[model samples]
Target: MILIGRTPYATCQTAANVKALRTKLFTTDGYEPRVRPIDDQSLPIAITVDLYLLAINDLSEVSETLKTTAFLGLEWEDAFLRWTPASYNKTEYAFWPQVEMVGGSKGIIMDYYEANSGWDIIDSSWSVDTETGDSTINFSIRLRRKPLYFMLSVIFPIIALAILNLCAFLLPNECGERAGYAITVFLAFAVFLTIVSSSLPQNSESVSLVAIFLIIQTTCSTLITILVLALLRLGSFDEKDEKVAVPRVLTFLMRKLKWKSRSKCSKVETEKDGKMHDSQSSLPDASESKVSRIEMPTQLHENRLFKEASTVDEFSWKEVVVFLDVVLFVIFAIILTTSLLGCLVGAQRNAVN
Candidate 1:
């Protein structure tokens, strides 16, 4: 036979068993629903709540919110709702009916929650007031945005842009787009920095190290754009022109490439020894001539020193500019990685705490 609606289902023999159980548990002659449900008024009801995270729904940087879906399980033993299997029927256990949310669940906390996503579930929490013999079970959960989202989108992209900014040095000098490329990359860095800064709270009480990293990279990019423009002129200076002497600072900067004085000293010693031997061969009997010969090599040494300086001091503006490019590129690259690692590690520790 087919049962229509809930009429016959509510009046069936099995339903009668449930109805009889309810009467025996909650009727006026057996127990009052108005009073506290537990027989032991002194003891508080203990409830256990568990949450299973299902999915991350959305994360809002501006609002600083994280939405998630999860499953909630609540378990407690209600003395009034208890029953015996043999009394109801021949079965393993006689289960009571479902429990509804009561007291509006006063203690639940929900900063970000999924409303209608099918897998969404509310968090669970329970509070018992022993003095008033009042208890409330409130389901609650809190979730944070995963670090992967920030690392992949904001942090890594800024680092990549900073690295790209350094690559302007690698571009051909003859290309007209070199200056334009550098300026364009700087502007992109500025825009990204703006986004990062704006996402943070506009207060001075706290500063983010990640934001500091971006600011440093942005400053580096700014200097790179300006330096590249300057190098466009400086790098193209004619190397053959002897009128423009390289700055002494640039000369000092390129000391690594300077000719070693050790080799020059060895050459000067060889020349002095050759001259002494020649003077001794020519005038072996005269002591006065020997003194004169020794003095003559002193003047020769001064002339040799002047000759070495003229050859060694041949510095062009073009060389200085290129040397600056290689050096700054390496330095800024180190700054980029070191600052990034330090800030990220600090952020990780803060998150863990």
Candidate 2:
């Protein structure tokens, strides 16, 4: 018998059973049976019956190949005179030379083992009950999946979307579009994840590698969105504030990051007055020296010194945001590379197996 068609994989056994034909020897009471030539030079004999068989699949290693087994046998109505093997010496009946050959039909899944070799005739046996005189002949066949279709349809698309998600980091934070870009890519990943989940078998005992990869990518996309928002916040600050005190930790971080800051040049009135007094004294001008020596109030000098100190102690918010962007991009690149490599290795391993 030949397998003509196959259905998609399901959590349960839903594929149609293989078709087979069963033959038995029977005798007419007083006359020889008549035969007529139907095709070629072979004569057609009557009494052959068609049988449909259900194949039980083992999905324990469904991530790889799916193996299935089917049994076919003959049963007789009369329990008293049961059918026996043609030769008791032989263990089981053998198929005719013509029936042993198998063929495949078009539109069947490419990786189907049955399509290439037909069902492998793994084992056959004859069973007889001594007490009841019941007898039967049984044969079993095994089938394996190719997995090419699933790889192309589901796995590849998901990986592509994951790579595309990394592009969100390339967008500039000042444009206020980084978050939007990341969110859009994240949504695309989600849609593809849904498509993959819908196609996978629902009753699987463990999650498939492809599913795990998608979950990780979704998490990464979410993180990218959050990072973009954080960068946006860092880029925004009150520009009018002349002195923005920076934390010590942030200062240390900036030093470590090698960020450059604009030099604060504050000209104090006290320093200018002192310089003027020194220059006038050298010129030998008594009135000019006295005028320059009129010291400003101590309170004003102290306030000017405090304001200069505050301005010098502040850091630039824009510089901090720029540094954050570089750091986040590095982290994002690392994640993207790791994910891509992991998926490629998995695909290679599956193909090899």
Q: Stretches of candidate 2 above 4 Å error? A: 1-160, 239-245, 263-287, 294-314
lDDT of candidate 2 over 1-353, digit per residue (tens) = 22322222222221121111112333322222253323233633344354544564555564776655654444423222223433232223322221211222332333544434323233333322223221222222434345577668776787787767777666676786778888898898888888888876665576767788889889988898888887777666635655355667777888887776653323345456656855555575666766544543554577578767745564667766666777777887788778778877976886555
Residue pairs clashing, model 1:
123-139, 123-140, 124-139, 124-140, 125-138, 125-139
lDDT for each candidate structure: 0.68, 0.58
| lDDT string, candidate 1, 37-106, tens digits | 6779898878899996757777789999989976576777767766665676633334444332343445
TM-score (all chains, Cα) for each model: 0.47, 0.50
Model 2 lDDT-worst window of ten = 13-22
When superposed on Cα atoms, how far off is each prediction in RMSD? Answer: 14.9, 13.9
lDDT of 1 at 21: 72
**Candidate no. 2 TM-score:** 0.50
